[model samples]
Target: MVALRGRVWDSGVMQNGALSELFGRMADVMEILAEDRFRVNTYRKVARIIADTPVDIGELLESGRLAEVPGIGKSSLAKIEQFVHTGRIEAHEALLRRIPAGLLELLRIPSMGPKSVKAVYEALGVTGMADLKAALESGAVAELPGFGRKKTDQLLKGIAFLEKATGRIRLDQAAEAAQIVGAFLAEIGQVKAIVPAGSLRRRCETIGDVDILVTVDEADVPRDEGRRTMDERRGAAGMGTGRMPVLRAGETLATHKGRTPSAQEAVIEAFTAAPFVDEVLASGPTKGSARIRTVEALVQVDVRVVAAGSFGAACQYFTGSKAHNVALRELAVKAGLKLNEYGLFDGEKPVAAAEEADIYKALGLDYIDPRLREDRGEIEAARNHTLPAPVSLKDIRGDLHMHTTASDGEDAIEEMAQAARRLGYRFICITDHSQSSAIANGLSARRLARQVKAIRTLNEKSRDLTILAGVELDILADGRLDFDDAVLADLDYVTASIHSGMAGDREKLTTRMLKAMDSRYVNCISHPTGRLINERGAMDLDMEQVVRHAARTHTALEVNANPWRLDLKDTHCRMAVEAGAMLAIGTDAHSAAGLTLMAYGVDTAARGWATKKDLLNGMTVRQLQVFVNKKR
Candidate 1:
């Protein structure tokens, strides 16, 4: 029976293109073998591409073309072909049997790696946490080479702490913390500028700590005006105009006049010494920092001060992906100089000390935008000088799709419109959910008409922004649109999307989406694949075909900004952009706070290398109005 079940599963996987299943099995095997994280990640990435690929995996394997896929090279292609030919992956199976399965879970503990897991297993016969703790109490862990009493205690504490604490906090959490600290620092008269740096600035999925850089002038300093007169004079002269002077050295003097030389020092002191901080580290007058344990995660806070003129460049340098900074350094080397947190130098001589943009310009490239500096082909792109024009928050003139009180949204038409106008948006389309989404107060014809009337009234009263009545019409089970053509046409902008009956045959899903796209009044498609991050999987559909249809029909696809969704993700956005499909970055905002999520949508768009030309919101107010009129 087991053999028969295995055969059935293999046949089904072969038929449906379960490349991820095979690759995931292989990754599990690699984990058992204690393979490096990067190698494991490569296999996983390759698996994802294969699972998402439209073509049959068997056909690709037979064609000897698997290496053509990104992140999959000769080594991976061989493994894939081996799995395709023989139902067994030998290396993975061997590793699986040799390594205890439970050890894989142990590796997930913070600061614990495969080597440590293996060590515990071998030394104490501890394959799980319960056994490991017994070994720790028995002093077996301390007896191991390099595992001293101190290290053992820390590991035990880490195990206990991580068991109760969340493993990693997302980047958004760090951003929130930074905003709080920034507001506090802003109130200080000495602070000239404060900007977040480090992984938080790079928008990494998780951050180790928060680094805030600040600039300040001597006049802004509060106390000890006369005693430290020489230090102030040096700060003024060495700081250079517009640049915050980096203090070489200073002494602690309590004059009570608020004579802080470095803004970074001030911010570091303020946050580290705050009531929220559970522990303080190395508090000094010049460069004190600390770690604060919040309910969500532990945040390491650091502050650095530089001359005012170089603050922007310094912030950019410090907030870098080390790999990106290294690439920039190499570029500087080729130009006969060195680059650092301060600024660029020519043969140990300060040549140009201005902003980050100026530094990039001096490197003989168009200013490399900070957001694009993720070290992923950006260096080559910069060298080839092919970087797209940086898309700004200002380039967005309106949100093409949003929700309101008519649906799940907290705000009414007038309130949402007023909020949009306050944020400098010229227009907003209220796209309430169709009747299928009854939970969101999905609108029927009569309710939709009432909402339209309210929007029209708001438009009449508002001079700065226009409010367009819209509907997020659902794609029903029968591959047909939720609302009839008559109802769709009554609205100013129509965004048709799939809500229910998400899982289905790929061809059926594709047909359903195509049918919606074919509608004359359908202006855009929301979320496109209906994926919720780390939760529900995307609906099975031909994404390339969907993008092509959207382009042909002049229907835009939305990159939903809600954190949980960022759907029509970066890769899909790039594909849609390449297909000439106009893309819209919408908050799909259910509340006024949701509007601010436009940045996340924009980030996803930029990650996809999208430029203003590729976005529907990039259009001028007049152009967008004309487009809406055309849809009508």
Candidate 2:
């Protein structure tokens, strides 16, 4: 109901993530209490179901259909209802009263499960990590059932590894992971749809976790159907097209159908045991949870499957910004209708249950793009029918910031250019690193001069492709440009960036970037905040001021599409657009094979709610040059 577009409101994807954690905690507490295995299994099943669900549990309960959902029953439903209404579960509180809350920390260690912990607590009086460590050191836990010296050593190592993964991962990391897992599940004969949900779907810059939703054909039950494959359409539509193996439509799955097996169970079994998965946290027919080992870190992944009738409802519910869904739920309430993952209903009479578009239509708002579901004003825009039609991967005319063997790039300039041409690009800029980045084989002034000459030399012979001389100029800690203006004047594009000093003072960092942007030689700022997904934190710079200055100076802010650094973050891109600044989407590629990665940045820009009008690369070759010149 807000009038301003993209209005800011503190929000989240509350229920699925929050409840999942709660249930996981409950499971731990039950195990610590050393309760019967059956009671613990019951809560674990509920957690799995809640984690996989697309909609809020409260919504399902409020609609009086909580018990009808698969895996939900009278006992579990009562606990969920009690927890939702009272903010505390009596059983959980009672357990907490008996056990030291600190003991719960033991479960987070990969090697420590409830039974293992229960045995230790009863044998050694160990209740927390500190006690557990002391017991391990004193040979106190070695003789406990299922506890061995080797296992103790592994737990010690696992504890240290767990501590390192405490913060957020770069959104691209989560997206890439989902892409890998989603692509893998797409070939499962029983899985009808595979869609990523949660913060990854909302396209947040940093992701806390990942969730993927699927529609399973219960009757087929994963029979290795020859028809289910990653056709060209799926390859293009799904994630990591270039990175993972695609399952062709006609390929055989090595296994045949089991006798009357449940489709959901079959898919979950395949997913939990996928080669990319490191560990299975929870597994059931309806939902699966696992840890995926990426080159960066072990990331948590969740998969939820819904029946076909509730597929659209599940998609919308799971792909949520808690604030956005809450807004929609409020809207539905005003219209005298109830909305849940099952579908929209008016007093139990079905309204829209099939397509997401129809659900939005039934709610009287034009379909709001998932990227705009941050409650930043998309709802009001949808009401006004003025929602932005964001720039798509197809709208890109060129990739402007890339490298070549002239610097650290794996491919030569000519090879990168040829790859761009094959992608039907009108222009490509050779933005190899300049003098300061020695590790990247940075180019010296003389080397840059030679590279520029070669680029112009190649452009003359090319018919469909236009090559632009560019430099990824380094900005020092003291706010000085690596290449002189004399060098920049001759180049078609210059991307100024901070390679080091990311951990310096915030005000100083902002000033340093502002100084770089003030230079007429700078066309864009690459990976404005030099964050490596999950590995490091963002630099302490004032992005609002930097974006405003870019708007004023006509310098473009780059969305570096390295999958590791989708910098400028979608929010910053939105801020840039709000300040009338233009954006450039670049793969910041170091090789020819990196061209396909532009889709990641395009996806990020769309999340920022940017359109073709907001992008500099959307311009034709001649037009791009004019824009460059105009900035100059």
lDDT (Cα, tens digit) per residue for candidate 1, span 514-569: 98888788889999988754334578889999999999988999988776677788
Candidate achieving the largest lDDT: 2
**Clashes per candidate (backbone, < 3 Å):** 15, 6
lDDT of 2 by residue, 1-632 (tens): 11112221112223444455566677877777767888788888787677545456788899998788887888778878765543335566566678876576677676687778778788888878888888888787877767788998877766655467657787656765675576567656666666778888777767887988877665654443412332332344332312112222453343323233356655666677565676888876578888985424468999887888877888899889899999999999999999998999999898988788889999989998888899999999998999999888789999989888888876788888778877789999999999999988899999999988998899899999899999999999899999888989999999999997777988999999999988988989999988765444589888889999998988999999876778878888889888999999999887676776787799789889899989988998777778778867
Off by over 4 Å in 1: 1-172, 188-190, 202-208, 216-267, 280-300, 306-313, 376-386, 453-464, 501-512, 529-545, 620-622, 625-632
Displacement of residue 569 (Cα, Å) in model 1 is 3.3
For candidate 1, the lDDT comes to: 0.69
TM-score of each: 0.62, 0.67
Give model 1's TM-score versus the native structure.
0.62
- Consecutive 10-residue window with the lowest summed lDDT within model 1: 1-10
Clashes, model 2: 6
